[model samples]
Target: MREIFEAELQQLGDGLVDMSRLVESAIGRAGTALLEADHQLAQDVIASDHEIDRLERELDERCVHLLAQQAPVATDLRIVITALRISATLERMGDLARHVAEVARGRYPGQAVAPAARDTFVRMHDAAVHVAGRTTELLQTRDVHLAAEVEKDDDALDALHQETFAAMLAPGWTGTPQETIDVTLLGRYYERFGDHAVSVARRITFLVTGDFDSEHAPSHRAEV
Candidate 1:
């Protein structure tokens, strides 16, 4: 019975890793679609949303099964609960990626920001890709230390986001008043990308420490 339970948990971990990979690719493709104005790539990412949703539902069901049958305790319970948390974060990442892709589709034949701002967005995209990649590492290794690296990485993205925001606020940024609003949202999308990565890092910390401190409010309930 214990062997079967461990195997089930291992499969749950595998599903989280796979979901992370899918979201990473989706976000990367969305970024490319945004920077390059590639509607087709954006469309592909948009169309892939159903696949992500399907994965999330399947993972949630597996988590429920693990809890129902295994009745995990201590570290085992932590692992199962962490899988649920990670799945939620991954699903949100997919949503953000799809949102970016939608913006890319709307970019048809024109854009809302300066060409220089677009270049900066390209850099932001790179930073987000790095974060997404590390999410997979965190799950695969279950390393709180590696997850710390992602928190540090979020600082870089925050820096980029601030700079982009400042640039957007500059006098000549908006070609039209309407365009200004769009540019602001574009920056927000990038910022929220970092935010999602930070959330994943926090989940990793929870998995290891069984506490959600270093977050806004620490979690008191123990998975065990």
Candidate 2:
């Protein structure tokens, strides 16, 4: 019974890694579609959302099944609960990416961001991609150091989000009202994407070390 339970736990971890990989691809492609106004890519991203949702549901059901059958205790219990939280976080991240793609699709055949604000949007995309990639790494390796790095990427995203807003409000800004709205929404989607990535990294840190503070926690130690 113990052996079977351990196998189930390993399977849970594998599912998380797979889900993170899918989200990483989604955000990367979503950013590309947004930048280029590629209708087909945007459509792809939007359609892929169903798969993310499916994974989330499957993970949730697995967690429930484990609790009912394995009756995990102490650290094992924590891991199961944390997996549920991380799955929800990843699902939200997927939604944010889809939202970005939707913005691109809505403005198909025309760039979503205006010329003057393109640089800021591009920077936002880069930061988002970095955060998403780091999130996948942290999930697979459980490397606490990657969690701190993910937080740093989130900070970069926050700065870029502010800069985007600043540009929209700058003097003599000439973008049409609709264009301004698209840029605003795009900035929000990218910012939220970073936020969700950071949340996942922190949850992984908690899962590994039972310590929520990634910065102060010793990298080499985990209570489990």
Candidate 3:
């Protein structure tokens, strides 16, 4: 029974890792498509919803099977439950990425961002990709301390998001009304990606402690 359980757990872990990678890829591509106004890339992202949904269903079924067959107790149960939550988080992240892609397509035939403020949006997208990648790695390692760093990383994303807002309100940027909206919305998608990564980190923390802080915001040590 022990061996069987371990094998199932390993399978679950692998599935989670695979899902995280797919989600990260989708997000990164979507961000790039938006910034570059690559219509085909944007369509690819929109088409990826089916893949994300399939993974979510597979992960959910696997988690359920583990719960029923393995009868996981204590930490094992925690691990399984966290995996379930992670599946949902990754699914949501994929959805946000799709939203970014949709915005890109909608803004076709026009600039996606203001010329002067493009650099800031690009930085925000890059930061979001980095945050998603790190948090996914943290999940695989079950590194609670590292997970905690996510909130601060999200804080950085928030700064970039604010810059988008600031630029939109600036007279120069608002001149391109459509581009201004797309930039603001794209910033929102990136911010939400960071927020979702933070949620995954919190889920990991909960799995370990079986306890949660009221605020549960990322701590100084979490950044590590």
For TM-score, the strongest prediction is: 2
Candidate scoring better on TM-score of 2 and 3: 2
Best-to-worst ranking by TM-score: 2, 1, 3
lDDT scores of the candidates, listed in order: 0.79, 0.86, 0.80
Work out the TM-score per prediction.
Answer: 0.90, 0.93, 0.88
**For residues 56-96, what per-residue lDDT tens digits would candidate 1 score against the true structure?**
99999999988998788988887888788779878988998
The per-prediction CA RMSD against the true structure, in angstroms, equals 4.1, 4.8, 3.7
Name the Cα RMSD for model 1: 4.1
Q: Candidate 2 on 1-224: residue-level lDDT in tens?
A: 98988999888888998888889899999999989989999999999998999999999999999999989999899899889988998998899899999999998899988998999888888888888889888988999899889989988888888898888899968999988999888888877787777778878888888875652344321111
**For candidate 3, which ten residues in a row score worst on lDDT?**
215-224
Model 3: how far residue 26 lies from native, Å:
1.0
- Candidate 2 C-alpha error for residue 156, in Å: 0.5
